[model samples]
Target: MTELSLIRNFSIIAHIDHGKSTLADRLIQVTGGMTERELKEQVLDNMDIERERGITIKAQTVRLDYTASDGKTYELNLMDTPGHVDFAYEVSRSLAACEGALLVVDAAQGVEAQTLANVYQSIEHDHEIVPVINKIDLPAAEPEKVKAEIEEVIGLDASDAVMTSAKSGIGIEEVLEAIVQRIPPPQGDRDKPLKAMLVDSWYDPYLGVVILVRVMDGVMKKGQQIKFMQGGTVHLVDRVGCMRPKIEQLPELGPGEIGFITAQIKEVEQAKVGDTITLAKGGATEALPGYKEVQSVVFCGLFPVDAADFEKLRESIGKLRLNDASFTFEMENSAALGFGFRCGFLGLLHLEIIQERLTREYDLDLITTAPSVVYRLTMTDGSTQELHNPADMPDPVKIDTMEEPWIKATIYTPDEHLGSILKLCQDRRGIQLDLTYVGGRAQVVYELPLNEVVFDFYDRLKSISRGYASFDYEQIGLREGDLVMMNILVNNEPVDALSMVVHRSQADPRGRALCERLKDLIPRHMFKIPIQAAIGAKVIARETISAMRKDVTAKCYGGDISRKKKLLEKQKEGKKRMREYGNVSIPQEAFIAALRMGDE
Candidate 1:
């Protein structure tokens, strides 16, 4: 059994692209957890998409063995977490498994918006934070300046912060030494009942569902019966193993240890993140705190290009969900796009990742409609209703009031772009709350409607600030707004999936923009197609795509002008007849092409 004093459980937290993954690689190498022959860049980021994008989409846990200068061997479990705001929940779960964290900051860039946000989150979790300045070998490296910035912005003492260059492998030994000396060891009671928390999980073809958990109060071993407290399922533990950079079957995992458990679970739902794992026969009386069910904040319709691929898409989603439990989907049918699934995601990045995964992993083409936020509707009869898709909304006469979700946005940027950033925020109807300066950087806070920022706010902010600004936001309670439901009509027929809720003030301009975009994308057919945007029964914008004309007069070569006129007359008559009876076929790309008409 490993002694508790020699076991250190910690996580590395930092903003995106700040050398977190590279530092992780160096630590894993120098510690001999994995041989140099087995070493690779971003080894913990196992996903191909993650490696290609240079971002950590999922949390990875690894065990490392290091011997300090004090002549003592220590076992370290490092939880590598995603830094993007969309994966904040994943970061929180990773932090829950560790007692300490390495706060990595870029030497040149200093502290960013996400850096402070995650630092405060660590403070909330009461994790011991050891500030580290990375990328010191860069041309712009300013370790001393960053150390002072860390003190000013995060209010943490950084005089003893480790300065290292992950690229050159400098100070790698000092970082490991700091982990052994500064970061406290994990503490728990081995005599207590089994009280392990499921930090993360994945599905394996041979072993079924595999779960990575941190044992808090008891021992876990193979052939033991375990109970998932929140999932309310019980099963016998078929295997218990620890990840020594690879899956190694262990005899038993005791307190303060991080490892995996396979309990013959066929379905992923049985092992949920944030759920407690205890003995089935005599489990602990109370479960761990801070257990929250993941909720989808943004929703959009995902239709296959070919209607026959609906079942294939559905099966693909099921397999994806076996690993990722954050996204949700349901059966949906669109008048223009045919049958599909209405999917829900944590945020825009999550939505994009899922869409890309569906295309790449399942080999199916997809068309996604404009994303929308959930709204709360009040009926005239005092009944409350939850609305995800605008098409499901009731008539205006039967509605009393509608409430849309809101968010608290925080932005950090250089003082030079303050004017443009503030203007952009105000244009989005963001209410300025406070503004302050810290370490030569400006931090601004605003309360904005979630609908406004869900689509174009990030892109616009980056454009206005020249990529110097960083953003982070959290969902606040819903607020009442002057919102209206805007519907799109193609060929005089309303598209249910294309309906969206927008503010009444900008509805006309946005609707006009959508109509114009659709006109350019929709192909001309035998009959002219009129695309219109309307609110309730009133039309707001309209555009008509002219029909494709054929050279019927070309066949009348070497004839008199009268003969050409007669041929034209005959072609017009045929077109008129076709217009009366023929239907316009709008391709799937037309609906998707209009989704980029900005946030409405």
Candidate 2:
């Protein structure tokens, strides 16, 4: 491409199901970047979970070549970022790769909580944002009203906004034109040391790891040695390439360009998502800036459903960790769970996707415990440790004091539902920091402990607001907070299956929720299964599962000699997954679901 027709790189960001990926598909199709049959509803959502859930999980990169209204052919590197808060770090990294972003807002829903969050993030990252009101094909869409919403809230001109129906390809060409007109071309010094941020990467068994990077500073040749900024690790490049919308490889990649690199980099850690890579010269120990290894925010305990499947689960995680080291795992030998790993995640979606992938992708039957955030635990020795799991921590008496992680949670909703949202937050121990009105909607920011509502905050918000609210949280600081180690006892023995360390104020609600879910999930075995939540010896709540009414009444079918033996064999097979506790082999989901439904 010539100087006049270089390129403009940008990302498309919006709330869940506001048509960001659909718009992406339409954009690629209009640009002839993707063929007709190759187009899917959410083309950018390439993962099975993403397609099944109808949400973008990982950030997807696509290159588009379009002739602008000005009659100039320009290369546009489009990034589709995950709409959920769990992958916020990935979203931030995606924003880093682009010079601008398409702030997609639902025409009728107006600006949602996530939309406002992205708008703020775009400004913070210094990206030139081109606001677009998508989903204008729907009869419920109010283009003029949303145009005003974008103007009043985002402080952008209404006339500048593109009213687009990405599903029907309506006015999407204008959005592309807006990208050419508003977003700036890629800026870099090609002669300088090659530098770029590894925005996204994936592992391929046949081709090793394919790296997706946007050259931010210097030229990236087909073969060059590079170093990561965070770890100072160096690797020799084998091939530098780019992907068109069809996933085809390109010849070369340079500064002011976004493309892929293959160094036979098998591990995803080598090509981490956020790390900046630069030329390895003079054995320099450092690299480019804006690189930070993400800190895991949510944690849970996991083991295989069958004790024999433990090794299978481990191997599955090992393979997954190659692509996502962010999912940290450490083995924990619990008397109740047998052997398991204390795993960490970004948030609930991250946790769920990992579990789902393990079961569906890796074909492993697994059991997971309740999710917990890091708790600042101060020991008697005047040292601090992040208490991720309550079971692993020493006694409370050994601690002088502890601070719990807190967050400044923001929830944007329609003006009519602010009262209900506030009431719901207040019940979850939220102290209102401030509330503002934007585009006839309310943006309510509150100071809340991360443990206070991490599990059920989003669910309750949707329930209270009738699915009109969206929530996002950023770690504010650690605060002097009182939290309890709420442990669950199964069969009079403390089982990690129901342990959740929650804010002290949240004990009642969390316990009640756990108990209620447990009642629905636990099978009625030969003995009554006791479900009790306690702080030490005190049982704050309790529920009893009535004993199972004889599951083997048909053990001997007509006493047909060998046929009866086969019938009994099948019966044993059916009950193979039940957890044996004093002659009751309970179903695995009862315990697993209890942990997942913690504090919800």
Give a tens-digit lDDT track for model 2, residues 1-600. 235236888998788878888888888889998788877677777688888888987788888888887787888889888878777778888888888999898887887777777778778888988888888879898988888877887787778788888878899879988999999887776566667888888887877887888886667766678777775677778776666765666555766788788776768876777887777783334455566777898888888878998888889889998777678988888776788889999887788899999989888877777677888888889888888887876787887877877888889888889998899888877899999887777889998877756666777788878877888888888897777788877666776656777677778777877877877876677556777888878888888887554455465546558876666576665544443536544467777667657334
- Model 1 residue runs over 4 Å out of place are 525-528, 546-580
lDDT of 1: 0.89
Scored by TM-score, the top model is 1
Itemize residue pairs with steric clashes in candidate 1: none
Please give the CA lDDT of all the candidate structures: 0.89, 0.78
**TM-scores, one per candidate:** 0.94, 0.87
Task: Report the alpha-carbon TM-score of model 2 versus the true structure.
Answer: 0.87
Measured with C-alpha atoms, the lDDT of residue 353 in candidate 2 is 93
Shift in Å, residue 34, candidate 2: 2.1
